[model samples]
Target: MNNDSLSAKPHYPILDGLRGVAAIIVVTFHLTEPLGTGHLDILVNHGYLAVDFFFLLSGFVIGYAYDDRWHNMTIGTFFKRRIERLQPMVVLGMVLGAIGFYFTDSTIWPLIHTIPLWKMLLVLLIGCTILPVPLALDIRGWQEMHPLNSVGWSLFFEYIANILYAIGIRKLSKTALGLLVLIAAVALAHLAITSPAGDVSGGWTLNAEQVRVGITRTMYPFFAGLLLSRTAKPTHIKHAFLGCSFLIASVLYMPRIGGTDHVWMNGVYESVCIIIVFPLIVYLGASGVIHTQAERRICKFLGDISYPLYLVHYPLVYFYVAWISNHQGVTLVQAWPSALLILLGGITLAYASLKWYDEPVRKWLRTKLG
Candidate 1:
């Protein structure tokens, strides 16, 4: 979300557009999740990998945007910029989730109404700071750190990755960074292949195993993207955006591989996508050139709404999931209309948040905090 300048490096519109595409896929993934009996049969089976892709994109952008600015930027200033860019949406997303929390009806979340208002408000206040609450604070019975907005879990890890970069990771020699990334890759692979579900998936909770999952998931792609930004030689690729988008869709939409008997097969697939395929997409996206004004406008629109879409879509999904729980026999086919409405409404709401809330608040924050 950083602005372009007369002297700054040119923006990568394709990367922004790709983020929007992945965010949409994430919405679909959530929409279809409750329909499945378990993770093994979800319709958009591999869609959670989008989180890893986002981590890589974030690392690449951070490296590109701030690596050189250390000479001019203090750590406090770096954090201020990040807070200004990210926290407004965080606060709004939590408030939106809180507003919807009491209305959701689900067998899975029987305690929402029973929880006292003060405790829920306490959770909301901590959520605005993006801190993970303990399981005691889990009012939603989902074990989520921020039960108000479950996706805040990923944002918490994103902040950890950012702090590591600013405090130490950015200072490593390329060889040292490469070595650390190699170690993280091995850890990630081990965790994925040996996981109970064999997909490296559980990170929303604040426990030992889940924290390990979150860290392993964050470290490799993030620093690999950092390494790529430092060492990449971007060559002009024809139709990079279109080609990369197809690659992403294929990876994310691939059906769950390896039945219960051969779980590692799915793990192998996920590891390959995260360790190799996603960085390739980021590199190619960095090399892409927009060919026409139409494509540029499309990219701009997608980029502008991607973050808001991601942060704000899930609270509404909470309601949809509750609906599925209440109406037991509704098939995915019968629910298509509601799913479509959720998709369209999410897009509309994200655009509105970006324009009506995010931009103006950010402008005011920059003036006050800059």
Candidate 2:
């Protein structure tokens, strides 16, 4: 099969499949609250770390797919492509979520959950770019307007990354490399601070405040990923070493569940360990030699749907939980049926969005913008 034709050669399936695995992990991780709270299962809860993995994967994929064109493309063209690819489905999700929230009459919800039209528009703008200044819509209080697209926050960084790539960083990816170092330094600093301080108020939850804090901590991991993207392709043995480093560090510095213990140095320990490990994981995954047929399939599939799933899963979970809690007499264990249903429903919605919205937009972009 020749490479030029769309189906002449099968693209990597293993990575696509890995995407499915990642999504499943994230879904399970979120559902863990219903399964059992405070009772930690390392494997399930640890999936929260998948967000880091996604960041790394983003750098590699971006680097792999678009690095060559970076020099030739104008910034306007670059951003236009991004908008066509990312904005359509995201905007759709936001609009759908706004409609859902309004109909549900969440204005009375204590968590300050309500989305007005103006707030929805602001979310669209934020989705278009990750602005330095905060943009707030006073739905219930001062917060970034589109909580529905909370997962969309990462897209902001991806935008920044695209800009960096366009500004001659693609020639040798110096920006990516620099970002790696900067991120590492930050991670180490944060780790050191938190290690002695203990888990700040909330460790890493979906709460608004926790989301704010978590973003700060995630910077290092994201940069670690950028480093891997910048790396020259490695040999199989080198890739193996990188993979091993990730496993070792994760086990050694597994973080504590609750508040930071200033007296105990665990937080610092975990931080240092993760900072080192994150890059290694990126290295291995980006290393073509480490990829397999099955893994690629999973990764790509999940990666394709990941954005939609991440965006809508929260609300779906909330509604599912509420429905079960009220009428079904569903205990957490019994909640499994509802949870599974939510997963299936979300996946279906993601597929519909991808096929109907994401794909059309992407095709249009490639034709007009590319």
> What is the TM-score of each predicted model, taking all chains together?
0.98, 0.70
lDDT per residue as tens, model 1, 1-370: 2222214787888998898888899999999998999878999999999999999998888888888899989999989888888899999999999999999947879998799999999999999999999999999999999999988988899899989999999999999999999999999989889898989787899999899899999999888988998999888887888998899999999999999999999999999999999999999999998999898898888888888988999999999999989999789999889998999999999999999999999999999997
Q: In model 1, which runs have C-alpha deviations exceeding 4 angstroms?
A: 1-7
Model 2 residue 252 CA deviation in Å: 14
Candidate 2 local Cα displacement, residue 295, angstroms: 6.1
User: What does candidate 2's lDDT look like per residue over 1-370, in tens digits?
Assistant: 0001124432433334444455655676666554433423323535555565555555555555555565676768766766776666666666665555543333223343445566656655654443322443434232443454444455554555556656645555476567655755575456445543343222223345555555554455544545555565644443343344346334433444444324235454445545655555545543434345554454566667876676566656556534543454346666777778888888888778888877787788688766
Clashes of each: 0, 32
lDDT of each: 0.90, 0.52
Candidate 2 lDDT (Cα, whole model)? 0.52
Candidate 2, which segments miss by more than 4 Å at Cα? 1-13, 34-43, 103-108, 111-145, 168-183, 188-219, 236-274, 288-300, 321-331
lDDT of 2 at 173: 48
Among all candidates shown, the one with the greatest lDDT: 1
